[model samples]
Target: MRVSIKDIALKCNLSVSTVSRALNGDYGVKSATRTSVMKVAKELGYVPNIAAKELVSQKSKLIGIILNESDGDGEARPAFFELLPHINKTLAIFNYRAIIYTINSNSYIRGEITDIINLRNLSGCIVVSVFRENHPIYEDIKSLNNPIVVLESSILTRICSNINTDEVMGGYMATRYLIDNGHKQIGFVNGPQNFEISNERFEGFQKAIEESQLQISDTAIIWSNYTGSGGKDSIHQLIQNNPAITAVFFANDLMAMGAISSMAESGILVPKDISIIGYDGLFVCKYYNPPLASVVIDNAAIGVRAAELLLELINGGSGKTVRVMPKLFEGKSVRKY
Candidate 1:
């Protein structure tokens, strides 16, 4: 048989109201009474009724982890996976639980997110990997009274906080690294335009080129999906259009690896024929043939920080933005020109 607060109260010979107040840690309850109620509750094997507590408190203890549906099929960025454990661990510190919700990237509409929040009675959400600026979901999230924290793309509200790496600086660092090695004829392979990070990185790339007085032909820059296959195709297109380019900077590690493999199939050697640098600083980069140079974002730090910010919002804190700095990881992929 299960034990209830009433059983504990009966065993302690206290009023039900006093027992409840002690169990809930309410102010004005005497410390001695609280300790006595806790001891009796433990002796009786009393368990908390979270659902009932939630009803009375008017807030759930559930935290939603929202991801794009494409992430399941390996079409989205891998950084989110790295972020998950940290977020989960941080939430556990506050006795909160996390639930993941994957929504279709192209098909999800307004009110769908709100519907999910209502159905689950979630206290807060951490949205990851959806980068489109004017999407219907963004509008819905903006109007929601519940707290939300977004990763990467910006969508600020009174209840929403945004967190991202300084992508422009990351892009600049990648480009500047290549330029410092005496490679002037460089190409850039970026992700699709709908993502704000893509544009920010591109801006950094352009800044490096202009400052160095180097010229990049229109044909040397290609915007493609952030996938391995997309990387392979972009490499072929880039090489075909600008055969004189001595180096390339990929916006992500997957594409850089894909391009490397594709180049090998065509009897072209990396660093020997062309140098490369990538972003995201994935773990696999260290093990790849010739290794890969990349701009590293501290995924674990970002995850922990995002979780902390969201919990603050849940507790009636004001919304704010946070941008983490990126560091460069050098590898054998970039050959000095």
Candidate 2:
């Protein structure tokens, strides 16, 4: 005994097609007729079948959130997790629901994105994944007709928009903080060089170093994966290679925490012996034994902007790029001279 549009149509003494058009607010239906149909629908307790409605309208109010599987340790996507609630909240305002689609980097290389979008009838998408510049996924995305918002990556398609943190400024802020605090012999621990973020951060670090009339040794910089364990090894190597180094900037907070634990194990105290700073302003940074200073990326802001940009594209706006600035969070991990 389920209520349907047919029940409302019969009660309103109107044809099914007229009732359907009235319910959807389609043109050619008078305002009074639409109101009467809705009132009759309410009286009959008519419930809509979403799939049937979508099939008739040919527009699914579904948004896709595409994520690339993490490279290692499965904890690399903390920022994406943080963005989920904000993105969903914003999309809900427009009566759209978000559907998550997880795929490997190789899937993009194999060009599986089209199938995923078409199969779900997604009206738009926000991609929260990282891929190298030469990856075939960039070309695959360009050929797509749907609105796409890419986070932490760039694609030069008319239908695609890019959003990311001001990475160069973030790198400069972290390194400059150390230099201003009387630490000249500084070291930098970065993520894999293949990542654009890693290279941009390196550029920022170099900008600060050169501006201060300082020269960094060849061994002062180390590139590693964005993992806690990678941090432990990088800090150990940095200390051994440059005993004169008094401070270091880690590309992410997880690595900074790992480096802290390794230093604790080796009886090398923080701040008293060396200072440390990090990027990505993770929540755990403020609660560590010695709070860690960091450059924070606002994931919530990025999420809202991404959703708005997708809507703009759906409404016929051209694709554009947006960059969120980073904020510096001071903690006890850095000591002033």
Candidate 3:
């Protein structure tokens, strides 16, 4: 009961071969004839056989999207989740479908990534995960022929194409924001080792410290996971190390919430005895008891842009790097000093 190209050909009074060429916009067909065929095809609501087209073109019209989960946890930062909707939005405009490749792996093996990528007949791939400066997988990806766009990678010289936010600047912004408000004894909670974003943000913290000429002894910094529980633990350690510390800057909002709750349990009030600032402008931050001040990074934009960048490589975009910057949000948590 459905319509076919042959049926359209018969209705248009054209040979089947000619109709096929016109529908495909083949070189031999005249523009006028092609337009006429397309007109009829539209009027008939003709849906071309995509499988047949793939056979002829040998292209899947599918792009590979790699989700590189960091921190060895199933939890993806709220910003990373934001990127997914934007990537889907951008791909919709290009008529290209995404083939998700999960890199929720802790092995850090090149073969794992290579095997997963080859399993799908993808025209191109976009790698989204937090990797360090000397990861072996970077070399392996560079050896492959497929176009790749890596997200949140700091080492641009080795990779073909990459897109990431200015994390160091983000770190600097968060720390400086605290410093600008006249808080001299500022405390900082650091993230785990080897993740590039952590290091960059750490550098930014140092930059602010350097500019202020503030002496941050070893006791002022406590390294921990970017989770709320980690933040809660780090606060105890930080306070134990430097009891006089009056303000704290948590690398992520999860830790900030933990610190806020723990402080309240012990008869401490935010910005009264201590001020707190956090990162990742998640929507949930707005509802906190004393709304959290944070660094606003557009995770959705990163996701969407990363997708578009991969598409360009598939359809013929030159290799290049993209960067996004983070901004600050002034919430109720920070008190004016």
Candidate 4:
């Protein structure tokens, strides 16, 4: 019941090879012929057999979307979810499809990534939310023969590309903003110490305080998980230990929101009792009781750029690195002193 390329060739009164070339938009096919073939193929309701195409070309058109299981129960980060649509749209332009694979972080060992690629015959991959630095998976991905683009983690190879936001500058901007507003006793709530972004941001925070000649107290910094509950717990612990702190910088928006909610329950108000700044520039920040001030990363741009880089790699291009800059989104949460 399905129309085939042969059927189109028969209707157009052309050789099967000529029809194939025209349908594929291959070189040597005249523009008029290609247009005619496409129009006729559309009239006949022809659907491409991707499986057959793969068999003939010996290359799958499938692009693997890899995520770490540790990011939480198969659901990707909010930032990653924001990036997905752009990545998918870009891939569709190249006639490629995305297939998601959640790598188990807890039980992962070396060589598993290579096995997955071989089994799927994937044309390329986009890895997201992998936090560990020296994990076996990184080593495996480095040695893979196929093209790959990693988000947030830096792993460069002949076949792989890396992309991330400029986290150090983001951190510095957030801290310096607080310092400029006259908040001398500032606290910093960071994610886990193992994450490279966390360390970079902390360095930025330290730089801002040092430049301002403000004392850095050990009790003013807390390293916690990148979760709302973790943020709530961290704020309470931070305030209890350093009651003189007049402002805080949270590494992410979720934690910042959690801290705000927790502080509200304790009769403390943001920008009134204490000022706050957050990272990740989540859209929901605009709707919060007091709009959140954050360092916003361009998720859409990152997604599109990642897709373009992966396509280039798949087409035999060499690896490269891309770092996007972050912008400060001023909101009502930060009170000007």
TM-score of 1: 0.87
lDDT score at residue 272, model 1, on the 0-100 scale: 96
lDDT of 4 by residue, 178-224 (tens): 98888999999998887778898899898899999999689999997
TM-score of each: 0.87, 0.85, 0.83, 0.87
lDDT, candidate 1, 1-337, per-residue tens = 9998779888889999999878865434677999899898888788899778989987677899998886424676678878899999888766678999988867887799899998989989999775576777888888999999998777888899999999999999999999999999999999888778899999999999999999899999999888899899999999999999999999999999999999999999998999999999987888999899999989999999999899889867888999999999999999899
lDDT for position 325 in model 3: 88
Q: What is the lDDT of candidate 2?
A: 0.86
**Candidate 3 wrong stretches, greater than 4 Å:** 1-41, 69-74, 155-159
RMSD of each: 4.8, 5.4, 5.3, 4.2
**Tens-digit lDDT track for model 3 on 114-137?**
776667666667776665557777
lDDT of the candidates, in the order given: 0.88, 0.86, 0.78, 0.87
Candidate closer to the true structure by lDDT (higher is better), 3 or 4: 4
lDDT of 4 at 318: 91
CA error at residue 151 for candidate 4, angstroms:
0.8
Question: Could you tally the backbone clashes for each prediction?
Answer: 0, 0, 0, 0
Worst 10-residue lDDT window for candidate 3 reads 152-161
